[model samples]
Target: MTTATAFDPMSEDYQQNPFGYYRAMRHEAPAYFIESMGVWALFRYEDVVTTLRRPELYSSRDWINNALGEFDPVPQVPSIISSDPPDHARLRRLASKAFVPGLIKKMEPGIRGLISELLDEVQDRSEFDYVSDFAANVPVNVTAQILGADKTIARNEFKRWTADLIRSGARSVLPQEELDRIHRSVNELRGYFTELIAYRRIHPGDDLVSALVQAEEDQQVLSADEVLSLTFIIQFGGAETPSHLISSALWECFGDPALLDAVKTDPDVLPLVIDETFRHVSPVRFLGRTTTQDIELHGKVIPADSVLLSYIASACRDETVFAEPDTFDINRPGLSRHLALGMGPHYCIGAVLGKMMCGLALGMTLQRMPNLRPVADDVTWLPSPWVRGLASYLVAP
Candidate 1:
């Protein structure tokens, strides 16, 4: 029987090692229908790429939040992530100015300093939860700094909000309490950003929020609501994705002595390691899209308005694309092509910042605590299908 028939994204087995199931799906049923989730899943590399690139045919109007069943009625938020064409393009253009690589590079010193301080907190401890103690802190602080939030306040509040949003999005079914927390966090996030945007309007600074506050394209600018939506995306994406990337990369490196040694010796190897880790264990597993029209693929027809879950994690491991795709190799060719950060018009705007934060986090950790070792016997992945990440990893210095 094809694995597709029994596939469950939220299963414990899938959470631990989804690659085997992904392999079966790619080989046995390229375009499989998942009933529980009510979406057509694309498993192969080329098919996922086609779905991602063809924005006109596959509308992103109903994106991640909608797929996770966030809003029962799903209010139409003016966010770039869920918009198509002219609207998406305009939002992207304004947001892009603040996310430019050159601008991101300027923030490196502050980011590096923050990473150093976080590591310092765990120096005396023999063992600690890397995810909670270190990995989780980097992105929140950086995101807060970028948006001009006071680090003291943003670190705690954004951490909770980001955690709730991520936890809420990971699973399709959740307890009522969890759902309530999720909605509460969403409201708190919007409320916080609304106040921040208004504050930035009058007292602008050299931060992303202020930049978005002032950014104008062709005499058109972002509305307060638009800015709020975009900020929500950036804060959540920036905080959650990189923490997993950093923790997962270290977990992988800790398993291989030679790879760990190679990264520790050469700073350049750290980025390569980060890329391979992303390919090997993608933090964000699948992205959602809605079909704009009926389309036939692999002799099956997908109806219009149906949600499509493109398995990006599966695409990253497609044997047709990478040699020994199952193996983790930093030297693997075409590492740049991995879709962990996504592709096309909706490619991650904070990619530059995300990579930098991860690389710096890994590099500095290796530099400061070269004797780091994993204390866990088996990796415990978070119980969320949308994101593949460690819930907690114990490590010793």
Candidate 2:
């Protein structure tokens, strides 16, 4: 008989060393069932790659919300990520029109400037918390400005809300107080976007909300909730993931000296280093979906109505995909395809732009900072089971 895996995810020493546990799962149970959560986790690269691409067959239908009976993964407002089809297509076009290529291109110089400034403040200090002082603030502030919100107000508020939402959702069940708080935040977030949309409608700025409001004026349109949903999605998704990725990437460089030296010396290796970092140290770990019909994989059937969770972080380290699945090799090839931003119809809208942000900010960061290394110990994880990022990485120059 196969001995069962532990029930509580946090019960494992995963926080201390998760990769070793993931590697074991790759062989023992590639398409294993997480008895604790009553959800199935797909660990190997091949399985994850296939599942992410076939949102049609697997059906992102109710899956986007990642539901369990009477429990909702997201709040009431449904964004494109939670949608499939003609609705998904329509919403994408609406959002895409606002998320213009020209706007992203314009963001490049500002990112470089922000990175330089952050590094400067840290230079005088022997040790500094990288995430709090630098990584966490920059992306969200930029996203808020783009989304037509006041950066200062949104920055502090957004960070608290996102972090709280994570802790509340990490469990199979949340307390009533937690549930109440989540709902309260959701209402506030909606109202917050409602006000911003109103402001953009009259004032008209170069930001994304102004662009969406103009789309409405053009006889192209969206509902009040849809507008609010898109705005919330843009600000939260854009801010959370990229900031997590940057801090996590820096942590990888901290542990590996040779990789650090190579990055310090070579400008050409920047892109690959970023790409590999996505694979090695994933920011968002698992996202769930409730399958509408039965599915078969690895000679096992996942019955319909089951909650399927993709171990996105584990997939990146699948031996079948990368040469040294766990190593942070700056020159590693096969950079073209990575699900770090996800895939298919609901692929991350901010992906290209997020990549641009990472390239510019991290590139500029290491360039000016000079001899930057992790301060080691006293670094803190956000206490999020979902986003595997530091609350801060103390840095010393």
Choose the strongest candidate by TM-score: 1
Q: What pairs collide in candidate 1?
A: none
Top-lDDT candidate index: 1
TM-score to native of every candidate shown: 0.95, 0.88
Off by over 4 Å in 2: 1-8, 67-77, 171-178, 216-220, 256-258, 377-382
Alpha-carbon lDDT of model 2:
0.71
Writing each residue's lDDT as its tens digit, candidate 1 over 1-397 gives 4376667886888878798899999988899888877789999999989888999998898785575465422245646878889889989998888887777888899899999999999967989999999999989898998889889867779898877766666445578888888888778777778888999999998889998888897998888777877777888788889999999999999888899999899998988998899899999999888999998988889999988999999999999999999899998899889999889998888887888889999999989998888886798898878888899999999
Per-residue CA lDDT of candidate 2, range 1-397, in tens?
2222532356435754467777777777677777766787777777776666766645565553543222332356566777767777788888887767888777667666766766677768887877788787777777876776876676668876665555555535677787777666666666777888898878999888888776643466877677777777787788788887888777877777777676778866667777877777778776566566788877778888777777778777777777887777766667555567777776788887787777666766777776877666556565555667776777777
The Cα local distance difference test for each model comes to 0.86, 0.71
